[model samples]
Structures are given as C-alpha cells and as structure tokens.
Target: MNSKTVAELLSQDVTLQDVTVKGWVRTFRANRFIALNDGSTINNIQCVVDFENFDEALLKRVTTGAAIHITGELVESQGKGQSVEIVVKTLEILGDSDPETYPIQPKKHSFEFLRENAHLRTRTNTFSAVMRLRSSLSFAIHKYFNENGFYYMHTPIVTASDAEGAGETFKVTNLDIKNPPLNEDGSVNYKEDFFGKETNLTVSGQLEAESYAMSLGKVYTFGPTFRAENSNTTRHLSEFWMIEPEVAFMDLAGNMDLAEDFMKSVLSYILDNNRDDLEFLDKRLLDEDKTKPQAERSDMSLIEKIKFVVDNNFKRVSYTEAIDILRNCKPNKKKKFKYIIEEWGADLQSEHERFLVEKHFKCPVILFDYPANIKAFYMRLNEDGKTVRAMDILFPGIGEMVGGSQREERLDVLKEKMKALDISEEELWWYLDLRKYGTAVHSGFGLGFERLVMFATGMGNIRDVIPYPRTPQNAEF
Candidate 1:
C-alpha cells in the first residue's frame, strides 16, 4: 500500500482496509497506543498497537522521537480527541532514539533550552507550527507579488555597496586573517580578496531592486540580508530575510496604498489557509500571557488580532503630528520612556512607536514624512527641505514592521544628499547614472520576513520564528 500522511487520513471520512503511514513517534502510551506526526500538520494521528501480537523488542523501540513505519487497517476511532485511527498490522523501526540521550521528549521545554537544541527543535509542537506558518506566509508573499504584476527579482547576495549606510556589514573575504597582504602604507590589500575589492553580504536589496524596477516597471526582491551589529535583543538578528518591492512612477501616496494593501492581502491569506496552526498558536499565546501581569496581557486573541488588522484600515499620520502627540503623551510627559521625545527632528524609538500603535491609536499606524536628517539619503526630499517622504508601518507589540519611502529620483538632489553624507560617488556611479538618464518618481518598502512571522505566529521572540537564528556570538548549527 502507498504511504499516507496524517493530514490526508484525518481529512477523509471513509475507512481504508489497508494503508501505510510513516512518521516519528510523538508519544508511546500504555505500549498499545501511539501518537504519530510527520510534520504535515499540527495534529497527530493516533495509531493503536496490538502489543500482544508484536515482538517485545520491536514494541519497546516505539519510543518518543523514534522513526517508524506502520502498516495498518484504518478504522473509525473509538477514543476521544481523534476521529480516525490506524490499527497496526505490521510495524518496523526505521531509527531508534535513545531516551537517555535524545533531547526532545514529550513534554513542554523552555525556549532557551530549545535554542540550544535547534537542530532538533522542530520536533516540538510550537516550532513545527511556527515553521509551517512561516512557509505559508512565504508562499503568500510570492503569490501576492505575482498576482499584482510584479516580477520576482533575484538580487546578488554579495555586493560592494552599503545600501543602508549603517556601516554594520559582514565582510565577505577569502584572505587569511592572521597574515593578510598589505600595501606599502600598511593597509590591508583588498586587491588580494576574491572580488578584488571590499565586499560584504547585502544589507538590503532595495538599491538593486530599484534598478530592475526602472526597467521592469515593478519588481521585488525576497532574500536573506545580513548585518554585523551585535544587538542581542529579541528584535535583532544577525542574519534575516527581507521583502523589498520597488515600483516605478509611483508617488508617496501610491507607496502607502501599496503597503497597506499588501499587508492585508498576505495576512488575510494566512487566516484563510492556516486556521489550524493559528488556533494552536492562539491558545499557546493565551497560556503564555497568563504568567504575565494583567496589564501586559493581550486583549485580543491571535486570530482576532489578525482579523482586526485585515478588517480595519491603518491610521495614517504625518511625522510632525506624531512628534507633537509624543511630546505631549503621558509617557513622555511623565518621563516613563527611556528616550524622551523632546523636539521635532528627534527620531522616534520603539517605545514611542508602541505607544502610538498599542496605547494611543489602538491599531496599525502609518507615520510618514519623517525628518530628512533622520531618514536614509535615498528618501525623497520635501519642498521644505526639512522632511523626507518616508513612512513606517507600526503594529501592536511589533514596532516598525515596514519601512519604505518614495525614492529621490532627482539627480541633483540625490547627488547633493550623497555628497553631504560623504558617500563615495565613484563607487555608486552606476546608481547615479540611473537618475542621470531617465528619473521618474519611484516608491518601495521593505518588510522583514521573520518579523512578519513573529507577528503572525504570536511568537514573542524573533528568534523563535526563524528556523536557525543567527545572533551575536551564537551561530551554532
């Protein structure tokens, strides 16, 4: 008989005379019942074992985390919590896991402990559900872009440009570190490197995506991005995935419309397709919040929160208005914020963003027209020359989920901004050439993939949403 997955069997109403199912044993109870999962779904398929007919040695091998193949007769389950079950006629142990050494057991384990055993963390229910949701969200992103006439562009991973200009980039080199080639001035000779010049992992694909968008009309880059910052916070990751979409002949208003629509589309996809996983996570989050103080608890469930974001329109406010509100808000007035908002040009921190989204607006908020000095050099300069056409979408508990802007397409304005920022004109001659030739108003936004997954799965830590998280001093497996 052909093998069937737990998900397929659970969805069927008719019983099968004979079937084969292969998966790892989640739990072996009473030496007569087994809960099997193959990572196909959040729920496990129950397998009833006739231990009296089976050999003692084989029955004992049906331990937790053990790989096994079972051929059985499918029948209506008489037990609770399941509709159908497998009555095992034949059993084979593919791999045996020693209970003494195997790290994953049939019990709740702390996230910290699971991080240490990341290679095997998927065996747990939480991690498996998270991974499934992440996969679905990825597909939803591609589907949304493809349906919207946007071509998926593959930008280079290794490049010689600093897109963000933050100076926190992971250097890509093949030269020996202990004894590297040096010039007469005792400077490290980058000529000996593989690229014949300094290169690093890309921090963002927006620059390259823009080049394609100018020609292709609309294009998006979804790929891994790296940063060398040593932040150990739950929100920071050394390596993460980013979604950047660039559209030609689009203004700041069009950019905001695209961002809002794109977010709702992808989130609505999750709600429609991944209902089981969302329910599991919703309960998990409620249980987790029980340990926190009442004030810190979430008012809406995971499903309700996602539905709210989809059903309601995001609140839009200008940077000036947001600054005014923050300057007079209770947190800033009472000095509760770690970084107080004092003036107009001051950059808003995460605390201030959360206040606007969770406390003040009580919904998703889009703040635009940021101070030019605080935003990236590529953002479009306003007529007043004090602010740029940049916008950030802030969500409850997850601040700044999307950051983007209408790009500075004017050659003279871009050159002036770059020159004042001390950016090397020679290095970015090709980029400047795009503006020199045929510049049109272009807009785009970048959304961190893991951050979206974190928000969707109700996972607190960004590390938990990603499969293998990379952070400061931690890259194991």
Candidate 2:
C-alpha cells in the first residue's frame, strides 16, 4: 500500500492497521517513542517501538533530525499523552544525522540561534509550521487570483526604475571591485555597467504589473523583490516576496475591494486547510486573549481572530480625519501615542495605524488620500493639491501590510509631478508614454508576502515567516 498521510491515518477509526511513514525524526523520547514528521503539517506522529523488537542499530541511526522510513501498525493510542500513534513493525533508516553535529535538538532553540543556522532551521517545529503555512498561502493567492480572472505576470527582478521611489535599491554593477570604472568627475561610471544606464534590483513590481494590467485587464506579479534599506526591525527585510495586483478601470474603492477580497480568500483558505498547524501556533505563539473559545475549541481553533476580518466590512478613513481624531484625543490617550499624529501631512506611524485598527475602529482600517508630499510621484493628486490617491490597509496586530494607489493617468499631470519631485523625466519617458497612448483608470496594491504570513500565522517577526531572511549584516543562511 502507498504511504498514508499522518492526517489520514489519524482520522481513521481502525486500530492496528498496517502503515508506512517516511519523515525526519524530530525527537526520540525514552529510547522508545520516535516523534517523526514529514514536514507535512506542524503535528508529528509518534511511533512507539518496543525495546526488545526495536533494532539497536536502527534506533541509534534514528537520531534527532535523521530521515527515516517506518513500517508500522496504526493504532488508536491511549497511552501517554497522545491521541493517535503507530506501533513499529519494521523500521528502515533512510539517512543518518549526527546528533553531535545537528543544531536543531529537541531542546528549545532561540529565534536568534535559528537565524544563524537558517538551513537547518526549517526542521524545527515553528519553522516547519511557518513553511507549511507559507506554501499554503502562496497556493491560496494563486488560486484566488486565477479564479477571479486575474492573469499571473512575472515581472523583472531588475529594472531601470525603482518602483517604490524610496531610494533604497541594491545596485547591480559589472565594474571590477579592485579597479572599478571611474568617470571624468571621479564618480562611478554607470556607462560601463551591464545595462549601460544605472540599473538596480526592483523594489516593487507594481509598475510592471500595471503595464500588464492595462493590456490584460487584470494581472498580478508574485516574486521576490529586494531593498537595501538599513532597517533591522522585525518588519523589514533586505529581500522579501511580494504579491502585487494591478487592475485597469479600477478606482480607489475598487482597489480596496480587491485587497479585501484577496486577503479574505487567502486567510479563509489557510484557516480551513491548516487548522492543526495554526492551532499549534495559536497555543504556542499568540497571546492569551487570542486563544480559541471553548465552544470553538476544535474546528476553528486556528483562526479565531481572523473571522472578524473576513466576515465584516473594514472601516475606511481619510488622512484628514485620521489627523483630527489623533489631535482631538483626550490627554490620557495622547500620552499613549509614541509620535503625535499632529497633521494631515505627517506620515502615519505604526502607533497611529494600530490605534486606528485596534482601539478606535476595532476592525481592519483602510486609510486613503495620503498627503502628496509624502507619497510617490506617480500617485494621482487630489483636488486639494495636498494629498494623493494612495491607500494603506492596516490590520490589528500588523499595520500597513498593503500599500498601494491609483496611478496618475494623465501624461501632463504625471510629467509635472515628476518635475516637481525632481525625478528624472527622461528616464520615465516610457512610463509617461503609457498615459499618452491609452491610459485607463487603474489601481493596485503591494502585499508584503512576509507581512501577510506574519499576520496569518501570528508570527511577530518578518524574519520568522521567510526562510532565509536577508537583513542588513545578517545574511548567514
């Protein structure tokens, strides 16, 4: 018979049925219990082998982190603290892992230690759960986009223009490190670079996705994007994946709706499929208030808090009202704020976002019409001339997971904004030509893949969600 999944094997009512399972040993308890997991779900299947029948050599080979194939009899376990278990009939040692060398022991390992040993970190319980959830979320995103008539477009990792306008792009160059090309002014010679002009890693795929969206009607680009920002916080990563969706003939409200739908679909799918893994995370990772209710103690254990986001409509607020709310607040609430949300032009900090989502609104909040001076040059300017048509989706725990805007569709207006912002109008000629040829009202959003995973899994750090995080000075794995 083919190898049965742990989930399938556990759910059956039969006892003492023949079974085969292949996985790496997670823990070996009392020289009798072998906890094995195939990197399937977070939960591991316990294989109980009698001391006499268990081969000494085989048992020795089945060290922690060793890959093993086990032939066993499935039984409804009543002994110890397990629900379902397998009684080993014959055990095969697939691969041996030296206990002395393996870093991921049964003992508790810190996140910092795990970051160092990035290659082996995936074998740990937390990382395993995160990896599974990440895979499921990726599938969920593709499924949602495909079902909703969205074409998946692959955008270039390298681009002439840095989409975010944040000036944190990692430069790509072919100049020799020892004796690099120099200009007459003693500056780095970009003309000698591979692209002729200056080129760098793309910060966002929104612009390229927008081009496809204009022609394809609806398109999304899902891939890795890099940034050289020197942020060492749990939220920032040097390299991370992004899911950017751009749609033509879509305004700000329509864009918000798409974001809401996309988030809901992905969350709902992961909550449904990865209940076991998520439940393990909830009990292990989340706060006490986030724990599942007694009535919903089994089925909906994974995503008790997320149901509110999926079921209810999000609260929408403009930048103007957000400032007023922050300014007119009582003295007690004023002291709680890290940075005072004084005016409309100020960038909304994480504190402000959290206040709106967690305290004031008590739901997900969509803040739109951000100040033009603070936003990118390509955003459509509002009539007030102070703000632009940008929007950010703020959740309870994680703030600003999705930041996007309606692109300025007029050639003249875009040019003027580019000039005012001191951006290179020559470099953006192709982008401006898009507006001149046939520009339809379009909108899109960039959902940080790590942030989404962080929100979904209740994992606090962006690094915890990504396998090998590329933070500044921390690229060991």
Best by lDDT: 1
- Please identify model 1 stretches exceeding 4 Å from their true place: none
- Residues 188-246, candidate 1, lDDT per residue (tens digit)? 99999999999999999999999999999999999999999989998999999999999
In terms of lDDT, the poorest run of 10 residues in model 2 is 295-304
Model 2, residue 241: what's the lDDT?
Answer: 96
Query: Residue 179 lDDT in model 2?
Result: 89
**Candidate 1: clashing pairs of residues:** none
Task: Encode model 2's per-residue lDDT on 261-365: one tens digit a residue.
Answer: 888889999878988778878877544434657642332323755776787688889988988887777632557677865555788788788777877887889
* lDDT value for model 2: 0.84
CA lDDT scores, all candidates in order: 0.93, 0.84
Q: Which pairs, if any, clash in model 2?
A: none
